[model samples]
Target chain A: MQPFIQFESVSKSFGSMTVIDSLDLTIHKGEFLSLLGPSGSGKTTILMMLAGFERPTRGTITLDGMRIDQLPPHRREMGVVFQNYALFPHMTVAENVAFPLEMKRLPRHEIARKVARALDMVRLGSLKNRRPSQLSGGQQQRVALTRALVFEPRVILMDEPLGALDKQLREHMQLEIRELHKRLGLTIVFVTHDQSEALTMSDRIAVFNAGKIEQIDSPHAIYDTPRTRFVAQFIGETNLIEADVVNVQNGHATIALGADLAAKVRSGPELQAGQKALFSLRPERMRLGAEPAGDNSLGMTITDCIYHGDHMRVQLARGNFTFTARCERLAGDWTVGTQVVVSFDPRDCTVLTS
Target chain B: MSRASARERMGALLLIVPLLAFLAVFFLWPLWTMVRASVVDNTVSRVLPRTAAAIVSWDGQGLPPAQVHKALIEDLRQAEDQQALGETVRRLNSAVSGFRTLLTRTTNAVRDETNSGAIDLGDLDRRWKEPRFWLALREAVPPYTDRNLLAAVDMKRDAGGAIVSEDPGASANRLIMFRTFLVAAIVTLACATIGLPYAMLAAAVTGWKRTVLLLAVLVPLWTSLLVRTTAWFVLLQNEGLINGALQVLGITDGPLPLIFNRVGVVIAMTHVLLPFMVLPIYSVLLSVPRNLMQAAASMGAGPLRAFWRVLLPLSLPGLMSGSLLVYMVAIGYYITPALVGGANDQMISSVIAFYALGTANWGLAGALGVILLLVTMILYFIYGRLSKSPQLLGA
Candidate 1:
């Protein structure tokens, strides 16, 4: 199927400073794509551009098959949820939800029905008569959601919708929204700076940096097979260790950590003997104080031990450098000041040249 | 029980007492004094209140009483200080020739006080007659009559000459007050209608254009009332900028009558008062969050729809406040109308100023002042109630 929304080399600039560089992206229909980055990385700018609030200095955005860059915001037919909820303080939840329909000049009864359905969708039916101020932050957020969703726009854009919520409510709303997206099969582009939020609610994440997308892929693929050092560093708790590629005779290459620590990676064409390389490995993939589990292992001094109930975070020191690894709590025995070996499967680490 | 709590409570009370005292002295005390004056009866030594502005011991209605006739003659005779009346009429000649007629009628009517006065107050009450007052009681009686102020609105004393509804319709009509209220409301609505777009432009634009617009909007705010009104006078004058431009453009070869008319007064007052509307709405619009409009648009509202449904509705608090401020201030305005309006176009404030300054009738002035205050109080109450109403608040 053709992408529902496409950013075709869409670039945005303010005066001379580019806010979004030449970027091309295709948002598939019925998919939740999260644009995740730190503040000032221009994730929210992309969302605003799609919402038609911000005009791109160059290039065009296409929705369905027609170019949408020139369309005024209201005609674009997209839903947006804001971090502050943006519920009209003056109007009751029902009135706020009914506004878009009212603007369309729909009959009163139809607006009432649609508003009721939207409130029910957000589980805020009882709060229909309450003003935004009368509701809690979570309830207000739900009201905002219901208000945006009442007219049934084909696509919804969320700019850090869960940012204003507390941790528990944010997590609760995340699952709720994820379920709604799946049920409705709505195309949603959610923007957030919270990595966990991106991980929890998205089918795929477009990791952004300095107004550019570093990687865009399925959540697991983004976490497991990040193409660049920045992506691997950004997505999860990955330990980056730079080493000399000492040996590469077979499909695997040996990466020397020091006289004390050395590891190997599954062979790749880019790996060369005597060349320096950096490898990223998830802490959870390594077992501390264990015999070599797979093709690679490192011996180190135990620096710190922290119990995480389900897992143990074991910090290791070798020579003058330190690194951390995790193992199942029951499978590992690690104590501070003890020398030990940390082992991981060779397939778990990715060798990055750039 | 707790030191911190005690300290906080003390601090709060310490903050409150001065403000309470200031209000009591400056507002409540003076208002109480005015009410007291309105009712106080002048006795052998002092004035004693029965109710505000209703201290008529003389029940002069229906039939003539000798002492009331004498008192009426004395008061009217004192009012026609032929020398002062001449000067007063001369001063007003430049402004209105009707002043000279008013002076002549007042002088001639008092000269034949017994033969033909407008109304026979002496007929309404009897005890108003006294031998000393028939000869010379103006100094002893103490000049206090609320008649003229009530007369300004076409109301007067009851049969007893105590302040009461004079005309049957006055109980419902409040004619002059209603007229004043209507004018104020129309001006407010007109200013808000014309000023909102300027405020929106000020809020939405940026760079040099925005700065210029902002300065333009605020220019009137920084101007003195005299200068602003003078500027309007210049623009609205027959041979002034607007008329000259119109003539040059061939809209009319002859200058149109623009100044010294009701239309000119209304136009100038609305222009002068427009800043009051624009500032409040502009401030509110500037503070409105950008996301709400975007959210509306993203939810299928176009730009105009988003503005109408979101921006405009959200802007209403400012609109309400601005209109109320403009209307309330306009109701009490005197100078603009006094200079630019005709006799019929003069508002309640102009009448009050006439009684207070031009005529120097303190009792009547005080009564008119009370009425203006009451009107202001009623307006404030309505504004407070309307702003608090859920429907308006929602808007």
Candidate 2:
């Protein structure tokens, strides 16, 4: 697909601190792409550069084959939804949505009509005359979304727009925003520190760390086949076991899991014989049973079993190596000091060489 | 209330007692006395009690009856305090001219005819025969009057006791009062024009730059008002630094008339009151979120439009308060105008000063002060109403 927005070797610095170092990124049209990372990981800086609020120290940002690095924010034709909503306190809900239309110098009746439709779209029509402070947080968030969407700009940039909401409301807004993105076919570049939010809403997730992109792919791919240890650990809970590769055969390798324990794991092309390999094993993927299932099985003693409402977290140990397995709460009466065979398919474990 | 909360309330009340007592003694007491001075008149009635009582019966058509004359003579003869009699003479003379000599002659004649009974005041002084003089005496006989308050606004009672505007050229109190408002408005506008941008700039910057900008405003505020006015006085003189710089820069062939006029008064007052305008606006600008401007821009507003729509409206409460502060303080300004203003540029404060100190007419001075206080209170009431509205604060 042709790129809608592209950043070519962009670098941003604040005095001596290099925030975004020599970065290259591309966003496709009508794609809900999320830049997910911890704070100070340069995710917001990229969004700001795209919005034209901050300038890159080096290289170019082109939108639709036109250089937009030199453009001012008002001329960029992009809408930004801020973390705190940034609703105009003095203006009513309708007026806040009508600001961009008025800026475009639309006629009074047209602006009024559009503002009404937009407010109605957000189910905030009854609150059109209320001030931002008079509205609840969810209502205010909807107003902000309506305000950003009222202008119908080329693209929309959201900087942690749902970060301030509570859990339930945040989840509800996430779905609402996802439905909107699909309904409008918007090219959105959302910046957030929330991994699940990115996973739930994004068509593509770009995991960022230390001013660099660790990996960028579909949520399934990023989660199942993370390219680096950072991405594996950042996305979800996983146990990284260090092992020495015994041999690489076909697309799989045999690795030692310490204390005479060995497992067959799928290896990437980078893995070789006699090489140290780290493999990621999700806790839920490991099955605990009374009998060994297949090639990747080990008899381990249960160190601790913790009940987690719907699931049981079984901590297993064999010699010096420890591993966790998540099992169904009613699967068995797994207790500490009980011996169990922990098994996993070779496809479930991917050897990572970083 | 619970015992602990009652004790807390008592502690708060105790903390405020000194303030309340100070306000009552130093502020409310003087204010009450001044207001009373404007309307309470007793000097004439006190010295000529019998005359005051008897004059009420005399018809307005002509001179008083013989009993009034006899009563006036008896009152004058019996008056022991020479100073009190002098005050009475001064009060009566101010009402009708030539009462000074007439009262002096009448007092001498009353003393000389002490052995006789029923001495006529008309016979003692021919001026006393005039009904105007008697009318002045009757008008002054009232224990309380609105004469001073009316005169403060350049209105007075005619001989027939109907309210009328004082003849033109008789007094310029009304003119000075209007001028006071005009000067204050001008200074307030100038301060807003300069201070709004200055405060915005101060609020926009950070670290040492903001500190420097604030210090520029604060340094002038910390300086004595008299010293600041004097600095302007030195800088505004024809051969002073401003003119000298202007002449040296060839801005003008001669020194401009920068002093002893409305220009000098406004310039000095604006400079002296600029901090009042800046601080409020600056603090308010600080409270306004910085992202709002960026948000406006991202929504497709240009810099100027964003400022006009977002920043300016948000800063209005500060601007209003600053304007109110500058205007109220400017209206009552005395020293800056006194030193820098010309004769015709004098405001109501100078008029009040002239009445209070120059002529010792405390009633007129107090009346003028009361007018100022009333105007300020009305404006403050309006400001209070405006600021209390949630829309103005953008909350």
Candidate 3:
């Protein structure tokens, strides 16, 4: 996997405020990578720097082993789809899609053929003559996508492209974009704050926080094994418990939840004995039963039980400690004030030092 | 309609009553009067009522019959208002150019004679026997005439009542009209060339920078038009700052002809009318989404190409409206050109002003005014159609 695009020690700032701080990142060829974070977290800035719309305050960016930091956006050979589709209003759909080809100074007949084929590929052949205002939201999004793809540049960058659509339409577009990425084998860098969207669409997700990448891994690995507390909390639901490491042996450590409760958990390299640590336990990993065969168990009372469509979220409490467990809907009618035993396999818990 | 809604509509109508009355009195009434004055003439008929009637039956070939001459003498003797008689003489003199002396002398002669019946007007003045004099009288006999309107365009009816162009060197109204349009078009082009880039610069910035740019355009607009034109007048003089600077910079051997010419008129008018061009373009550029340029760049369009394809097209509505506005205002300009232009460079408005106020030829003034009004209406129609397009709104 050769790196197709690289940002080497990049730092971007506006006046005195820094948006990206000494960042180093690599994007492989034909890989779908997403930069996911909340607003003002600089995820969009990284995408913009890659697209050559913004110059880095320091350091350099290279694409295909060539320096592209100084190049203008037009010469960067990357297609960008904006949040609000910036389609040319004065031009019809066909003309809008043919803009890049015409800029490339391609022959007239060839440009027309490419524009027509691209429009047909997106199922917008009937809308070739319509202006962007005459089209629906979803249709405009499709036209924008087609226009960006018609040029077939080195990579495609999308900045919250589907944020304006309704829920159902957004989900549909998410899958459509994923399909397009796969069929074209494009090296795409997508920016979004929607964690689930990044998870469902990207081959790798870079969870960003405060202008730096917290974790970069496959979506499953990122969700199942987050490297930091921010990544774990940002990705999905989890219960974090303050604990002290009691002992460490090989790749696992024993952490004491309280004076009377202790649990064995898998730890990363930074954990050691006699140090304060945070233990992360996913809600779905806990089992609500009197199962004595598990490596860890605790006796608590059900304080609240919330019914989801397919699962039950039972909140349990024991003295000062509180935990939530997601269990099967038919897991024996757990309700508030019902005493229950919560257990989990030690392999499902992760020990965090920060 | 429901009671409440109907009451609301009534309230809205009442709110607009003052505005409607103002438009009717101050705008529409004057417009109507001017239009009527261009084609309606009754000076001859009012002074010589019986003569006007008697001359209608005359063949208008060689001379009038004896009864028509007797009727003229009777009408002239009975015309007691001296000012009214003078007005009639003045109106007829404009056509034949000798009635001022001829009518005044004849009026005195007819009044002094005790026997007022059967007076032969040829006995008083042999010039009256000339067929041209009677022809001028016959031409003036019509209460409604196209003389002023035809004269506005430098065309007139011959003795046989056929329309023909005025003799060469006789009048320069038509030449001045064409020059007015030409000067306006030149000024419009200058404004567009300078205004488009200025508007884009204003739109590209934000915060205080944008405020500064807009203020640069607006400060000039807030000043009086005459004051601005006067400022240009001082600057364009040969011994003024512009020439002094040019001399210091060694751009030319001597001061160029920067005043009382086409160049001076164009420069001053462009400066005076630039805000009209810039404001519309700036507003339209503001409404256009800023990301379109970036989108073009992302799609492999350089700055020039992106501007030509995306930004320029998007801002075209503003450019067109600005050009039309400048052109319309430029054609009607009087003070600037009069102050800064040479005598030969005066536009049609100067001619209209001379007719309206200088010579008091209100008929010709109104006719020229009607021509200008028609041109403005056509341009406004085009502007209305352009603005109605969805593209103009940046949809």
Candidate 4:
């Protein structure tokens, strides 16, 4: 099927500065795609371009095979949830929801029925007469969501919609939004700087770095097999070590860390003999013991041991590199200042390049 | 109430004592004095107390009884002895046109004669035989009458205690009052129409542009009212820059009648009051979140619809306050109208000034002032109630 929205060679520049450069992306219908990055990574600019709030300095954006780059924001037929909800303070919840319908010049009775149904969807029906100021933060967010959806726009854009809520409420709202997206089968493009939010809510996450997509994949694949050094460090905690490729074979290579330390990692085309490359090892994948059991193992001195409720974080140092390893409490305690062998399976380690 | 709370309340009251005293002495006292002066017709009763008392019961159809005549003669002799007859004559003359000369002629003829019954007052001045003169005296007899208040509205009570419009030959105060309100309303409307968009632009901009716009609005407020009015006077004159520019542009074949007219008055007043309208509106517009407009657009509203549906209602309180400020100030404006307006375009404030300083009719001035004050107070009361809502105060 053709992509629901297509961004073709889009670039945005402000005077002497470039915010986005030669970017291309596609969003599928009924998919919850998240653009996740740190601040100033041009993720918001892409979202703004898609919502028709900002125009690209070069190239075009198309919605379902129609060019929408020149369209004004009101004519774009896209619903957007702002970070602060942006509910009209002068209007009540129902009035705010009815505003888009009224702009469309729908019949008053149909508008009222739709407004009531939209409020009921957000469970804010009783607050139809209460102004935005009277509602709590979460309720206001629901009202804003209801308003954005009440007009039945084909696509929804959320720009850090849960950024203002507390952690507990943020998680709750994320689940609620995901449930709504699934039930309605509405295409959504969500932008957030929080990696965990992207992980928890999106069907697919596009990691952004410095005006480019670092990687795009499912949350499991993104966390398990990050393609670049930036992505490996950005998404989750990992132990990275610079190693020289000693030998390359079919689909795998042996990497030498320091003297007497060698590990097998999945190899990329950039990994050649006697060349330096970074290897990413998950903290939870490594185990501490006196004897090595996995395909790859290394001898290290335990520098520190931190007691977490579920697992102990064991810090190991070997030849100018420290690795953090999460050891389950079921595993026997390893004291600090003791030498141990840390081991991981070859399938769990991936080689990353700059 | 508990003693401690009561004592605390007393402390609060004590803290406000100086301000309350200041307001009473400076504001309320003057207002009370104006109200009293508007109705206090004491000159006639004070000078001719017996005659004033006698005429209250007299049928106004004919001349007052002989007893009233005798009392008036006694009062006139007493007033002449004290050298106070001139004041009474002047006061009575204001009510009826020729009373001062008539009273002076009769008093001069009767002053030296000791027999109050021997002299025929009608022979000295046949005008005394007319009951209209007596009716005028009776009109002024009451210590407090609505004559000044009625005259303020261009109406007065006739001899039969019926309210009637004052003589049309005299100046019509009601027309002046109507013109004052109309001019104020027009100036207010002009200020809102021009200032609203200017304020929105100023509020919507940022950096040096906003600063420049704000300074442009505020700098004019520092200039003296007289200087500004004079500036308009120079610009709007027939031979001045505006007419010269118009002629140069070939918009008119000759100089337009711009100065000393209603148009000039409204333009100058609107310029002066525009800042009052703009500042409040700018502050309100600044407080409105920019995201709301974006939300409106994202929800399928055009720019105008967003402004109308979300922004305008939010800024209404500011507009209301600005309108009230412009209107109240415009109605009481004196210098600008005096400099730029013609005789026919002069507002009620000019009339008040003419009555108070030009003709020394303080009672009439005080009456017109009371009316203006009452109208302003009523408007302020309504505004206060309407703005008591916290939503109007904003989030």
Candidate 5:
């Protein structure tokens, strides 16, 4: 099936600074896509360009096989929700939700019906007469969502729509919005700098770095197998240690950390020998026992232990390098300043050279 | 209160003292004095003396008795025969004052002692049934007659005190003030309509476009009202640039009579006050988020529709503020209309000046002034109430 929307070699710049650089992305219909990045990493810019507030410096944006880059935002038939809700300040909640219908000049009765249905969808039907000001932050966000959804547009674009709410309400709104997206099967393009929100809400996340798509995939794949060093360092808690590839043998590359410790890393691609590589590993994948485990082994002293609610994080020190290990079941109580052996399976460490 | 908050509050109060002083002395005191002047007859001097027998004595409860009114009318007539309209113009013209002319009827007509075009009934001592004295006495009613207000409108109700045609030949009603107010309302509405879009457009534009539009709105602001009015004068005067251009373009054979007219006054006033319209609206529009427009645009409404639905409604506050500012300024405008408008287009401020400076009838001037101030205050209040809820400007 044709992709719902495609950004083909799309790039955007503001004066000397580039916001989006030759980005290529495909948003499938009925799919929830999250554009995730740091604050200035062009994720919101991409969403804005897609929503037609900003145009790409070069290249075409196609919606369902036809070019939509030249179309003005209103004619594109996409619903948008802003961070601050952008509810019409002068209008009541019902009037704000009824605005698009009024613009379409729908019959008053149908507008009333649709407005009721939309407000009820967001669980705000009873408070329809109240202005957006009288509503709480979460309620205002729900009103904005209903406003966007009322017109039944083809796609819904949300730019940090839940950023204004507190954590509890934000989490609740996330679930509610996700359920709404599913029920409507509306193609959603959500932009946010919060990685957890993107992970919780998106079917596919496009991780942005320096005005380009560093990697785009399911959240699990993006976290477990990062294509670039920037993506690997950005997604979740990671321990990236610089090392030189000593040798490649039997599909596993041995990386030499120092004169004392040499470890072999397993990654998807066949890595060549003597190349400088960054080894990325999740702290949970390591075993904190005083024994060797396969070809990946290291000696270190226990520097510190952090008792997180779910697990204990053990900090290990070896030479000039420090690494963390998550030991779920603490075995043989180990104190700080105790010498120990930290072992890990070679397959857990992925190598990204750039 | 904490020391800093206290100091800041004190500083605010101190800063406000000058504004309060300015308003109290210049705006409020004059209004009070004008109201005082309208009620008390102090033609002898600015004092009520023990020799109240010489005054135009009237019972504030009912009406003046016939004898006191007789003395008052004879005294005023003797003063009119002496050509003493007021103390100031008596001192102003060295040549015109000494000579006598047919001014008693004009003075009586303007003062409401006689109905418009009605011959003066000379003696109030006669019986009330005598038609002549009865007509004049009937015209002169109570402690405070709205005679000055009528003179301002150039209407004098006849002996019955009902609004009637002043004369078969003389146009009883002025109709100029109504025309002036209509013109002012038109200018205000025009400014709001033309300026609202520019404000919205400026809000959307950024960097160079925004700076350019701001400069466009502000260029007339920086120029003095007189300079702008004069520029209009130069352009509007016959055989001046506009008519010259029209003639050169073969649009007309004769120079258009554009100067010293209502059209010229309106055009010049609009040019002078467009920035007033733009600034309030621009400030309000600037504070409005662009995302609102984007959100509305993305919500399946076309750009114009979204603007009408979302943007314009939100911008009503700015429009109201701008119109109020422009109208207030326009109503009190003196120099622009004086330079550009004809006799028929002079507003209340000009008439107030005429009474104050030309005739030096400070009593009449003060009365007109109180009316203008009262109307302006009322207009301001009505505008505030209509703009929105009071909380908008932190009332």
Candidate 6:
């Protein structure tokens, strides 16, 4: 299917500093795509450009095949949920929700009915008359969301909408917004610097780094098979080892870890023999003992042991590099300075050759 | 009601006592004196008590009887001996312009009437026979009269002791009062109109730009009122910079009448008081999140619409407060209007000065002052009440 929105060679620069370097992306209809990155990664800038608050300095942004970069914010008709909510303090919840429809010049009774329905959708019907200042943080966020949705624009963009909420409330609101998107079949472009939030709520996550997209894939793929060193290190805890590629055959590559140490890793098509590559091994994939046959094993000394409530984290040292292995406490404790054999399946390791 | 709490309360009261004493001595005492002056009418009645009493019995339609005339002479003789004749004459002359000569000559004429039987008080001067003179005396005889208050609005009593308009030439106090409020309102509006956009700009920018904008708005406040008014006078005069610039621009064929008018007064007052409008609004605008405008824009409002819907309403409290400040100061302004205003453009404070200093009529000044104070207090009360709204705080 054709993309509902496309950003082709989009670039943004503020004076001498480039914020978003030549970027290209396509968003499908009714898909909840999240732009995930750390601060200053230009994640929010993409959302701003799509929402018409910013224009791409060098390329074009098309919505449903129509060029919209030159359009003013109001003319673009895209709803934006700000990080601070930004609900109008002087307006009641109902009036805030009715603002867009009023701008469209809807009839008074129709505006009333639509505002009532929108308030009801957010379960803010009882607070329709309360000003934004009178509502709590969570309620205000719901009001902001309802206001954006009430206009029924072609697209909706949220820029760290839940950044201001406490952890528990943020989780709750996250699920609520996810459910709302599913129910409404709305296309949402969410921007957040929170990795876990993007992993939990996005249909597809685009990991951004230094003004360019590092990787774009599903959450499971991004977590399990990050293409670059930055993505693997950013998404979750990973044990990285710099290795020299000994040989590459088909899709498998043999890497030399250290003197008298070797491991097999799954390689991409670009892998070459004698090339240096970094292998990303997840902590949970590494086991405490050499068990589970058909897995590669490495001898190491236990450096430290951390007692987590649900699991135990053991630090393993092999030569100059340190690796962490998450293991169930029921599997038996490994004391510090004790010798241990950490093992992982060769198929689980990703070789990054950048 | 524990001992410690009671002691704390007493300590608080002790701390506040000095402020209360200061307010009483400096503020309340002067206000009470002005209020008393507004309604205090005692000189005529104190000196001519018997005549005052006899005149009350006489019908206002006709003159007093023969016995009243004899009693009036007796009172005048006693008043001269008591050295209260001059005061009595002065008080009555305030009501009737010729009463000073009328009363003083009558007192001298009646002093040697011991052998002269049944001396007619009206025989000394044909003016005394006029009922208007007697009516003026009657109006002045009240211990506490509304005469100053009435004259403040250019109304006075006629020969028949009925309310009537003062002579057209002298009855400009009402017009002056209207012009005072009009000038104040116009200046307030002008200040607000100019200040709102300036404050928005100052608040929107940051760093040195914001600092420069704020300083520009506030630097005028540091100058003295007279200096600013004189500057305006120099700028707005016929051959001044403004007219010269206009002439150079070819906007006008000749120099416009910019000075010595209501426009000059309003322009100068607005310039002098604009910082008052700008500062409050700027502070409020600074508190308003910029994201709200962006949100409005994202919600399909254009820039002007967003400003109108979000920023203007949020800044209303500041606008109202600034307007109140400018209006209060503008209504009571004397220097600006005195320096730049035409005779008809003078506001209430100018007339107050006229009564207090030019004419030495403290009673009329006090009455006008009380009205102005009452208006300002009522506006302040409304402001206090409206400030309870959360929008006013821009939270």
Candidate 4 lDDT tens digits, B1-395:
99999999999999999999999999999989888989897877888888888888897878877888888887777773344456778878987889988987777766766654567778778888888888889887889978788889998877578999999968679999999999999999999999999999999889999999988888768889888878887898999899999999999889998889999999988988899899988988887888888889988899988889888998898898888888888889888888888999988988999998999887899999989988888878766765566776437
Interface C-alpha RMSD after superposing true interface residues, each candidate, one decimal: 2.9, 1.0, 1.3, 1.4, 3.4, 1.5
lDDT of 5 at A74: 76
lDDT tens digits by residue: candidate 1, B276-313 = 89888888787677677777767777777777777898
> What are the per-residue Cα lDDT tens digits for candidate 1 across A1-354?
568888988899988999899998889999999999889888999998998888988998998889989888888888888888887776788888888788778999999988888888788899888888788999988887777777788788888999899999989999999988888888999999888889878988999999999999988888988888888888889889888888996788888877666787786888889998887889899776556555666677888878898877888888787787877763435467777777788888888877
Query: Where in model 5 is the C-alpha error above 4 Å?
Result: A15-17, A103-107, A249-251, A267-269, A290-297, A305-314, A326-335, B1-19, B44-146, B154-174, B219-222, B386-395
User: What TM-score does each prediction get for chain A alone?
Assistant: 0.95, 0.98, 0.97, 0.96, 0.94, 0.96
DockQ-best of 2 and 3: 2
Candidate 3, residue A109: how far the Cα is off, in Å: 2.3
Question: Against the true two-chain complex, what DockQ does each candidate achieve?
Answer: 0.55, 0.76, 0.65, 0.56, 0.52, 0.54
3 versus 5: better lDDT goes to: 3
Q: lDDT tens string, model 5, A1-354?
A: 468899899989899888888888999999999999999999888888888898888999999899999898878878889998988777789988998887778999999999998888788999999887788899989998888888888889999998888999899999998998889888999999889999999999999888888899999888888989988888888898888888887778888877777887775465878888888888988887778667777879988889988899998898788998888866666788888878888877888877
Task: Point out where model 3 deviates above 4 Å.
Answer: A248-252, A268-270, A289-293, A305-314, A327-335, B48-80, B93-138, B392-394
Q: Is candidate 2 or candidate 5 better by lDDT?
A: 2
Alpha-carbon runs more than 4 Å astray in model 6? A246-254, A259-262, A290-294, A299-303, A318-321, A330-340, B1-26, B42-85, B92-143, B157-167, B391-394
Q: What TM value does model 5 have?
A: 0.83
lDDT of 3 at A107: 99
Q: Candidate 6, residues B1-395: lDDT per residue as tens digits?
A: 79999999999999999999999999999999888888887777888888877887777667768767877888887774345667777678877799888877887787775636667666668987898887777677778878788888889876656899889988788898898899899999999899999999999989999989988878788988777777887899999999999999999989999999978888888988999899988888888888888888888899988888889999998888888878877788888788898988888888888888898888899998888889889888876766565654536
> Least accurate stretch of 10 residues (summed lDDT) in model 2 chain A?
A327-336
Would you list the rank order by lDDT, best first?
A: 2, 3, 4, 6, 5, 1
The pairs that clash in candidate 4 are none
Task: Encode model 3's per-residue lDDT on A146-243: one tens digit a residue.
Answer: 99899999999999999999999999999999999999999989999999999999999999999999999999999888879998889989999889
Say what the interface RMSD of candidate 2 is. Answer: 1.0
Given candidate 2, what's the lDDT at residue A39? 96
For residues B137-232, write the lDDT of model 5, one tens digit per residue: 323322355655655555566645587545544532245456656777878988988898888788888899999998988898898877887788
